[model samples]
Target: MDKIINWGILGCGNIANKFATDLQTVSGSVLRAVAAQDLDRAQNFAKKHTVERAYSNYTTLVNNPDLDVIYVATTHNFHYEHAALCLAANKAVLCEKPICVNAQEARKLVELSREKDIFLMEAMWTRFLPAVIRLKKDLDSGIIGTPQLVQADFGITKPQEAGSRFYENKLAAGALLDLGIYTINFANIVFGSHPERISGYAQFTNQGVDQLSTYNLLYSEGRQALLSAAVALPTPHQARIYGDKGRIVIDDFYHPQQYQIILNGKKPQQVDEIFDGFGYLYEAREVQQCLLGGKTESMICSLDETVAIMQVMDDLRKQWGLRYPNEN
Candidate 1:
């Protein structure tokens, strides 16, 4: 019999709800409990997700002996702290992307996870999608001769509300953290390494958040990636990987359901991945596999890779002179 992996969710937010919903789709995972700052909100979320318990205190959820793991679905600013708390409790963690606000905290979390002998992975869901998995296998099989470039953009039009995390610098709100990281991860996967040089610019909102941003990554051997993200606009959310022999195009790349590989002198080979409910299941399944296998880190998205990715973002933020209020 498969060991059931009970999960405790920290932060009953939108992403947390999606995760809880997706838990129903995984074979060995169950949403045992959820925690939010507001007790009433936590109870309501538990009722909505049919979870057995809710807590207003995060530590209580983390220390729940029944849960095998904890998913940190909080805002960017709280990822490090909340994930640290869970790790201290000897709980496995699947933190949402960006992992933390910057690379420094990312390093701390990675080190702590190792010291505690606990599982830890940045929930970079794009890396685990079926289309993405097939894409990697094809790329490795030389379908696209040599990946030369990657291009992608994720943009959404959100209101500039003052207290909203998307527009608050103190809360680490910005297109770069919320959206651009997807493009960065796409580039990293295509190139298989960090860019040699990074150049970028951004349009900042009056609230001190990036409204829209574009960046260029220069790699060795003249390889490159161009990407963009915006919070006040809507883009096609498309991605394209240009190779020496062909190109792969992904529509709605971040949460892609379909992709096509256009090879030289051949019809476009396309693939459509159909799945039930939210796409978060793939990552959740990865966590389940890791726990079942007694693994402390994800093979698909390793902690070293998360730190490297965070370092890239840190470098970019340093160049742009973008510092959150929490960071000195």
Candidate 2:
């Protein structure tokens, strides 16, 4: 327990690379191993990141007793299965966003993590970003008094191609799960509650996945959040929270480093946050701190919250008549 905490990565994808790169920035962490379904990709990632071990199979990586925790960075479909594997092995997990394709799977993973007495958290990295930290504080302090409405948009234009990951039903690919979740999470962060009434619509691709999803969420007392996301168009990747007293605006909010506060009668004041890397070190540090403190869940991104977000996605998908192969 005195030595640095050993970490293992369960996917060798691009997101895993970013996590590995930032893991080095934290003082009490070490990337002990890396794994992928593809052995060659695993070895290459290990070599590039200078990890100590690489494995083609995820179970082998999780079974390693030296590892203190594992990061689940695989595609959406694999998140619940991989995280459950790690927890069953009595290893802690920091699974990537959305937790799973559906709330049922997410809840099962959470239950297993609790049953195994190991840590589990959704890697909702945006919550741990420097700018968001300040934003949370201001909101809590009533800088934005009684948030009445919130708005956010995330859209990326991609060439429509059959079986593309963004529109492939087999992969659980859809604008709602991939991009809309961010906007949903942002609303949750601001309102600190789930929407009571959920209504949304999605434009489906030929593959039967959501190409563009837009919706309005109604919280308690008629408070609302307007959210939109698309894979076929470019929209502002920004968020705004409006309260009686003022509003907070954040651009590129998912990994934001700066945000603005505009009061009712005052000029806009900007708050800039400084970070060394892509700003993932904050969450990496959070994992280390939780392990060191013997905590099983993250305060920043709880298991319940992850499941709630997935439930919203499920409802949205249902509203659009979109269903993945496995779900059927």
Candidate 3:
């Protein structure tokens, strides 16, 4: 049996808590430590997870010799620096979504991971879910032949507060990066290529952050994707793909609890798959498998895919006039 990977968490946030809980469900993984900007926060997270070490500073956590991998659960703008620190310390990294603020930062991280010969993967948990895996299989099987259109949407009602990260321009918080990334990723999976022409518009909050947006992605092959996201409304969070022979509709697609496939005007077929431990288990298993096989990146969500996704995000931001403070 291979040795278990000791995971260190940077940023004791809600996502980090979910990851830690899911880590317990994977066999060859263990949460060894955590770090937060506040000492009390780190200690509290460590206590909750029963981890051995907690550091108030991320640098100290990255330098811990006992850790085999570091999960960067920091905000979008900080992903680059935190992931880079872990990679520089010769530790593998599993970073949260929107891997970096833009394509430039994502490309740099990919390059550094290669030069350092360390494992690194974006934590796009939705892709690893069982429903999504099955959806990919159905697409490959041509159940949906020559996909023509892909539609997806995600949204949430968040209160507008100046200090809240969701409405803060300095934190790179917006409907596009937070909610739209999921819709865009789903579209990319169905289309299998970056859109040749991308256009979008957004409604911004008083704080200069986008509160809602809609995007239209047109591919060279004549396929189109209509994606929408919002921070002030409740969307189905569903997706649909239309093809020549049939169609597949993913209910709650981003984190689907159930889905159905309709073929050539026939009856709908339902798919039911239950997830265990907050749905982060699948990604954890992927990380364990990658480490055991000595691979530098996940084939499913490779560095190239992450960079491509970020490029789409950058283009959308350009259209909406959204810019992070760090970019200036």
Candidate 4:
């Protein structure tokens, strides 16, 4: 019989709800509990998701021995704290993307996860999507020859209301963290390595958060990536990989459902993928497999790579002279 993996959500926010909805789609997965700062909100989420338990305090949820793992779905600012709390309790963690605000906190979490001998992975859902998986496989198969460049952009139009997490520095709100991460990670998967040199420019809001940003990365062997992200604006949200022999284009790379490969002297070949729910089940399934197999981390999205990705963002923030309220 397949062993059930019980999950406790560390935050009852919008993302948590989406994750919970998708978790139900994976076999042998249970939405055991959920926790939020407010008791009323936790109860509401619990009722909505049919979660077994709900807690107002985070510590209580992390300490629940029945939970085999915890998904830290909190805001960017509290990711480190909430993930660390779950890790310290010896619970496997699937943290939301950007893992932490910067590289320093990411490193600490990586070290702690290793010390605890628990599973840890950044929920870079793009990495586990069927379209992305095929894209990487096709690239490795040499169908595209040598990839020379990658281009991707992600942006959203959010209302710039007071205290909105999309525009508040205190909430660690910014396009780079909230939206740009998809573009940067897409480049990482295409290049198979972090950039050797990073240069970027950012336009900030009056709240001192990045409103729009663009980054150019130089990888080894002269490979390059041109990426951009923005909030309060709309972008193409497309991704393209250029190689000597051909190129592949994904209409919505971050949550892609299809991609087309255009090879030299050949017709464009298109591949389509379909999945149920919000497409988050792939990552959750990975976590379930890892736990059942006694694996401590995902090779597709390793803790080391998570830290490296964080470092890349840190370098970009340094270049742009951007820092959140909690950073030194």
Pairs with backbone N, CA or C atoms under 3 Å apart (clashes), candidate 4: none
Off by over 4 Å in 1: none
TM-scores for every predicted model: 0.97, 0.97, 0.98, 0.98
- The per-prediction CA RMSD against the true structure, in angstroms, equals 1.1, 1.3, 1.1, 1.0
**Model 4, residue 99: displacement in angstroms?**
0.5
**Pairs of colliding residues, candidate 2:** none
**Residues 1-328, candidate 4, lDDT per residue (tens digit)?**
9899999999888899899999999999999999999999999999998988999999999999999999999889988998999998899999998799999999999999888899999999999998889889999998899899999999889999998888999888899998888888899999899889999999999999899999999999999999999997898899999999989999989989999999988999989986668999999999999999999999999888888878888898998889997788
Model 4 residue 34 lDDT score: 92
What TM-score does candidate 3 reach? Answer: 0.98
Measured on C-alpha atoms, candidate 2 has an lDDT of 0.89
- Name the candidate that leads on lDDT: 4
TM-score of 1: 0.97
Q: What would the per-residue lDDT of candidate 3 be over residues 29-102, giving only the tens digit for each residue? A: 99999999999999999999999999999999999999999999988879999999999999999999889999
* Candidates, ranked, TM-score: 4, 3, 1, 2
Give per-residue CA lDDT, model 2, range 1-328, as digits (tens): 4568899999898889998999988998999999999999999999999998999999899999999999999888888889999998999999987688898899899889888889999888898888888888889999979999999999999887875768778878988988899999999999999999999988888888888889799999899999999999999899999999999999997878889999999999999987768788898888889989989999898888888888988888888788876786
What lDDT score belongs to each candidate, Candidate 1 first?
Answer: 0.90, 0.89, 0.90, 0.92
Model 2 CA lDDT for position 64: 99
Could you tally the backbone clashes for each prediction?
0, 0, 0, 0
lDDT of 2 at 58: 94
